[model samples]
Target: MVRRIETDRLILRTVTVDDAEDIFKWASDPDVNKFMIYPLHKDIEVTKEWLRSRDIDGNDEFDLGFVLKETGELIGQGGIFYKEDLDAWAIGYNLRKEYWGQGLVPEAMKAIIDYVDKEKGIHAIVGEFAKDNSKSRRVMEKLGMTYWKDCQYSKFDGSATFDAYLYKREF
Candidate 1:
């Protein structure tokens, strides 16, 4: 089972079926989805279906939602994607527009990184962000991730693509 992690002001926990509405609220926002790998979800059913497809009980990596501990409000989602061949994991996260600039993402990410390094025996954690997203790049740097490569990443809209910076941090 996925474990719950607590920081001073946030809680990181597994996504649940009941979280469909909360997921839809932020994920459907075009601004939030602009730099994300996937397109903005069109409806609640789409969000529900996506959540249903996730495997929380298997060895597959998990995605978690970031919640405000005080109010139990969902603010963002992020987690590690296990890469067997690399013997590492890739980290990713997205926050609600209203929560931007609050330093919550970094806090949540740091906590998760600590968990992965200490409990999961991961050798390193990797991440890639659209080059245009300077905020995200800053978060990676804050987590002590160093720039390692550059490559093109396909956007949700098949009509175009953009450059991305790959980052990595070894344990």
Candidate 2:
């Protein structure tokens, strides 16, 4: 089930079908999807399908919509995916270009990380970013995760791949 989390200026809650339009606003941005593994969304239909298929069972993963409390607008999304190979939760997020560099990611993520640790009984969390995505790298560092190693990631279809740096935090 989707859970609701409140921070100083934002709310982290499970995404729903109604959020399709807002999510598409960022999901469709080429600049936003540059380093993302998923292909740029061509239309709102694709985003709707993704939001519809997104799992909210709180099992292996959870995707949340980051809502700005001041305007109740969906600014972005963030979540933790369980990596079975590493036996740890991997954190990820994306935001609209307009909201970039505002330090909003760590605010939303800090809440998610805390929730995972307290509720899921997980002590280790990992984050990865494309080697050239320095913006994401900074966000990871601000989250107190340290550089762990370099790794390669590819889309499910194996059509595209890139080198990435892994960051880790263990409590």
Q: Pick the candidate with the highest lDDT.
A: 2
Runs in model 1 lying further than 4 Å from the true structure: 156-160
Residue 170 of model 1: what lDDT? Answer: 90
Candidate 2: clashing pairs of residues = none
Q: Give the Å shift of residue 145 in candidate 1.
A: 0.7
Give lDDT tens digits, candidate 1, residues 91-152: 88989999998899889988887786676677788888889989999999998999989977
Q: Alpha carbon lDDT of residue 113, candidate 1?
A: 77
lDDT of 2 at 22: 96
lDDT of all the models against the reference? 0.85, 0.89
